[model samples]
Target: MSESSIAIPTVYGLRSSGNCYKVQLLLDLLDRPYHWVDTDSSAGATRTPEFLALNPNGKVPLLVLDDERRLAESNAILCYLAEGSSYLPADDWDRARTLQWLFFEQYSHEPYIAVARFVRRWLPEGHERQAEIPRLLERGGNALDVMEDHLGSECYFSGGAFGVADIALYAYTHCAADGGFDLSRWPRVGAWLERVRAQPRFSPMAA
Candidate 1:
């Protein structure tokens, strides 16, 4: 924790989740102090009464302020934590552009890439869900291709600097191969990953 984060909020999240890791990454990038409470939505953890009270949606990456104010949704948390920081764009148009990419990540990217990783990591190979892997990979690859094209032109999703959009997309895109999506084909996207990793105080996803 940095001196800047001395009295910030508590973060309840699963260490392995990309959604949760995005918040963790932003907090680290901003040098914001936060208490990370390990909370797994899998293994029936998020469904528990205590966890449900925090987020009725029964999800991880929930943020609770010192005053007991709670906020859910991973991207929303990123926006909150990055406000007034370099991670968030000061101009209105650039900020909205950042949001545009964030929305693309959740809808067009994570649904395929992240879900494929979850199934592959947690489910048995012979399980019925394994049948979906091919389609997931196909969709995930398409999302990656889009990223490759965009990243080929702009150094970062924020246009000039690293910001929340880059973090949001980077979460799953970096671990894409875990879902069986071959990343070697997208050189531009791969380079962007390295750029984001090179940022100061950047932290890896917890093991």
Candidate 2:
């Protein structure tokens, strides 16, 4: 089909969670307009057969691109949209570093920092998941420590310039206190967060 005949892109996500916020932030940052579909996974919106067809994992932050093409995994969506932009590193090794931190953000950081924030902010009062808060706090702290060490040497997560690496990690890192992880201790990280915020067209994650 011709490009003009394609449907516009649309993104589906819950309000909370850095995973979802990453996509929203990138879309806002780039001015690559799209429709936003508010999906509440906790309310079973993600489990429906229709949503599963879009993403079998049943996770939020799924993107349906122009012409009905679908992309899942927020990082993948970021890369797809960022292909020709400054947000994507051009040098092979430098680009790899961005991917490395993006992976770390998902594997090591998101479970602790993002999950903890979800439990604290999204879960109802007196929820049993509160029992895991301490573990979440510890893991989140460790992630922040790694981030602090890295940011001490580089202005951005991947290196000198702000790229997908910064956006991928910054989504949750900025709101780490919601997960009970303190930012006061990580001065470098705090500075990095400020840098990301200062970028032209920088967008805050939806409330």
Candidate 3:
């Protein structure tokens, strides 16, 4: 399709969500212009009939093209927007390797880190979910240790350069301390976070 024939996409997301912020970060980094619809899942926005029509699974970070086609999942949207950009690896094994880390972020990293952040930072104190904090911190720290070991040997995750994997892991890992995990214990991961921030067009997560 011609460039003009393609529709600009709209993102439906909560500004504070790391998953949502992942898409926002990449779109800004690529200099791709798009619309943002601030939808908070915590406020029952995702469960609305209109949003359910767009994504039956009812999640934020949903991307809707002007043509009405929709895409879901933060990492999937990252890969789509980053196609042909330096944020995505071009080499065969490198791209697969990037996917590996992306999967690791979702399965190992985000589950622990993101959840703890949500419960600790977003929820009121004494909320029932605060009980999960201990387990979350333990697993989240394990994930960070893995990253620390890998980063001690190399600069970025996956392709020896900045890419989607970095974006994926960087989202929650950088804010892990808010979840009660001490970043000082993982110096390599700390340095990697700084490296990601130094990349051109980087933006901090919404406060």
Q: Model-by-model lDDT, in order?
A: 0.89, 0.85, 0.89
Worst 10 residues of 3 by lDDT: 1-10
Cα shift from native, residue 92, model 1 (Å): 1.3
Q: Residues 1-207, candidate 3: write the lDDT tens digits.
A: 335423578999998899999998998888778899999898899999999999999998999887777899999999888887788999998999899999999999999999999999889999999999999999998999899999877899858889889998988988888889899999999889998899888988888
Off by over 4 Å in 3: 1-7
Model 1, range 20-42, lDDT digits (tens) per residue? 99999998887878899998777
> Ranking under TM-score, best-scoring first?
3, 1, 2
Q: List the residue pairs that clash in candidate 3.
A: none
| Residue pair clashes in candidate 2 | none
For residues 1-207, could you state the per-residue lDDT of candidate 2 as single tens digits?
244422467889985668888887877788767788999988999999999999999988888866677789989888887777788888898889999999999899989998898898888989999999999999889989998888777788664689888999999899998878879999999998999999888888767
Q: What TM-score fits each model? A: 0.95, 0.92, 0.96
Candidate 1 deviates by what RMSD?
2.4
Better of 1 and 2 by TM-score: 1
